[model samples]
Every structure is written in C-alpha cells, then in structure tokens.
Target: MAIQTAAKATIYRMVMPDHICPYGLKAVDLLKRNGFEVDDRWLETREETDAFKAKHNIETTPQTFIRGERIGGYDDLRLHLGKRVRDPEATSYRPVVAVFAVAALLALATSWAATGSLLTIAAGEWFIAFSMCTLALLKLQDVESFSTMFLNYDVLARRFVPYSYVYPFGELVAGVLMVAGTFMWLSIPVALFIGSIGAASVFKAVYIDRRELKCACVGGNSNVPLGFVSLTENLMMVGMAVWMLVKPMGVGVGH
Candidate 1:
C-alpha cells in the first residue's frame, strides 16, 4: 500500500535555559512519521515564546499549524493524525504490570545467585515481597495523591481518612519484614489485616458497585485500573502472610 502523506504542518517550540520542550520534538517526529513535512520553527528566547503564546491565545508551547489552520499542541496533532491519545486521568495497568515484572526478574536473579536455580519457593516469596515494597515506594512518593485516590474505593480509608496514609507505611514494613524473614509475629498480622481489607474493598468497588476507578496500588499518579491488579496485590499479601505463618522456619533463610 502507498503510504499516504498528510498536509504540511508547522510547529513552534521553545529552546530556553533548562527548558527544552520535549513535546516539540515529539510533534516533529510524529509529523515526519506520518509523512507530513514539518516546518520546525524555534522560539529562541523565553520572551519570544511567551509573546507567541499570547498572540496565539494558547496556554502551552509546541503549537502546531497545518495549512494555516491551528492544530493546537502535541496532543491535538496526535488526535488530528487519528492516534490513540491517552487522557491524563485515564486508567491503565501498565505501571502495575511493569513493577511486578521487574520484581519477578529481581526475585529470579536473587534465587539463581543464592540457590544456583531459578525455580524455588524462596523466589516466589521474594517476588511478592519485592513487589509489595516497590508498590509501596511508588505510593510513598506522593502520599497525598495516593490517599486521595485511595479514599475513592478503600472502605477503611473512606471511614477513616488517616488509614489511607498509614496503609502505605504498613505495606512497606510488612514487605521488608517478609524479605528479611524476621519479625513474622508482626508482619503476619499486618499483612493479613491489610490484605483482607484491600481485597474486600476492591471486590465491593469493582464487583458489587460496578464502579470504574483508578487504582492507588502503583501510586496516585498512575492510571492502573482498580480491578484484577488490585485484587492480585491483596491476594499476594494474604498468601504471603499465610506462608510466613505456616512455613517451616529457616527453610529459605540466609539466602
């Protein structure tokens, strides 16, 4: 099939001190990829950029114009090109999936280094512990954002706002304890309690209420959907708590 070329597009972007606009480059690239010849215009100074924005009555930079018709910024250009443009608040699973994948890799590597094999029970435990820690860390980065999103679906958080803040810290502590294989007496209860509450909240929100919302599992800024990923995280915690409680001591220790 002959690749169809789009109409020529013009872009104006800023290149100032510590303020190189990334979307401008993206806009140029997208135009070229779609076979549109781009007239790349540079605003050399901050004053020029601001003046351009004022004249155009636009708020942001990297503005695009096609055949003398204003096409807005990078996102607008993308829409004009018929591409999937993700909303800032849209829900997705990429963040949680990425964290879990990385955790699994790290667990496998650790197990291989210690036991000279990848397939081991210790690896599974390590994977869950690492996943929990990573997820908690993301939430901790922006606790207020996480808490706000969490309150939307978390039953306990809805009742008590303080619990939303506490949840991340508790998750982090439980993950650390699990990884160290020490303080089972404390970690077990913490994991079980949080896990049970999380599972119930997710079930009620997604299944019973049928509400679609973003998950705070990866973080408040993330777009991870509130459903299977959330349920899996809670289930992992529950399983890890049970395993820690019943497993033979020192079985996976010192590795």
Candidate 2:
C-alpha cells in the first residue's frame, strides 16, 4: 500500500459483533496521532467485511486497504509504519507484553486450584495440557496423531504416576512438578520448555490459522490478535515457567 502523505488518511475497520475495539481503536489512535483523520462512520459492517473480501481478494477484520491497496491486518499495519510512515516507533509491544504478563500471573495462580483433589486436578491437568498440545499439533501437525497422543499421555501420566493409572502417570506428576519446579533452581529451563509449548501452540494458530480464531488459551476474556499477541502470551508463560523451574515457588507466594 502506498504511504499516505497527506495530512490525513482514510481507513475503514470492520468489527465483529462480539469483537472489542482493539484493532479499530488502535488504528484510529495511531493514525490520528500521526496526523490522519479517521472517520468513525467508515467502520465497516459484516457485509462490508465480506464485500471487501470479495472485492479485493482478502479476508479478515481490521483490514486496512490504504489507498486501494490491501494492507492486511495489524501486522501489516505495523509494516506499513516501519517501511513508509515517518517516525515509526521502534516496536509496538507495550500493550502486548503487559497483557501477556497478566495472563501468566493468572495461570500460575490457578495451577494449584486443580490440586483440590488428586483425581479432579489430574483430570483438569489432562484436559488443559492435552487440549493445548492437541490444538497446537493439529494446527501445525507438529507430531503425528499417534505420537502426539502418546506425548499428551506422557505429559500427564509419566511425571505424576497414580497407583491405578491409565497411560503414563508420570506426566501428570511432572505437570505439578514443573509448576512447582519453577521456583527451584531449574526454573529457567522449565520456563523455557513451558514457554516453548505455548509458543508452538500459538505460532501454529497464528501463522497457519491466521489468528482468525478467538484464542481460548487462557479463556475468552483474554482473546486477542495473533502474532505479537500470541508471542507475548508465550513469552509471559515462559517467564513464569522459568520462575517456577528456578525458584520452585508454591501457592500463596505472590506468584
């Protein structure tokens, strides 16, 4: 897309019915800050989103077609700023990073809630870990289904071996171990591992699915864009994981 040299630029945003106004608001804010007039009425409807998709051979929300050229999503918007717009910020990550840090903190707090019952916690652990791993594997096909299934089992069964268990009980133990381990000397490695898992999951979802899907990673409340949003989430997870593996803190330590 050609750079907008005039004092103002015209951009249209399509908001999903349930969508909050992040992309739309951010675009308007940035453009106005950089000397552009954003017409609030220019916001598009679902029909407009679909129509533009057909018209310009594109598909997605917050789609920026600057000067009749499709600039794609938020990432593309950043790219436009970097390549064309003057005084581009070195990088736009404050919002992304802040959101991620908050999520990681939340995850750490909830990890222990599962321990209310061995059976109950075990089930929850299996559900979340396998769910995340499967989604990642499905999106990326990182591992064959057979292997992925086995790994998922390994995650919950091996580390936490229950006496009357199915699959590798050790894995279930490890989940708790790693969560605890974050506070121990091994915190860094554990954090990296956990972060890697999250990163891979998010990467597949973003790069492959194109961030079209609302993330259920933490939950619907935290649903956000792909790319930087996902990356920040993983990074935050990695930070918490490292803290766990290194210091091995338990519940109630301001985790």
lDDT of 2 by residue, 65-111 (tens): 56666566666776777745433434343434553444344444454
lDDT score at residue 162, model 2, on the 0-100 scale? 37
Model 2 segments more than 4 A misplaced = 1-6, 15-21, 40-44, 83-255
Residue 242, candidate 1: C-alpha displacement in angstroms? 0.5
Stretches off by above 4 angstroms in model 1 are: 1-9, 32-38, 54-59, 65-70, 253-255
TM-score of 1: 0.84
Clashes of each: 1, 38
Write the residue-wise lDDT of candidate 1 on 133-198 in tens digits: 999999999999999999999999999999999999999999998888888889889999999999
What's the lDDT for candidate 2? Answer: 0.46
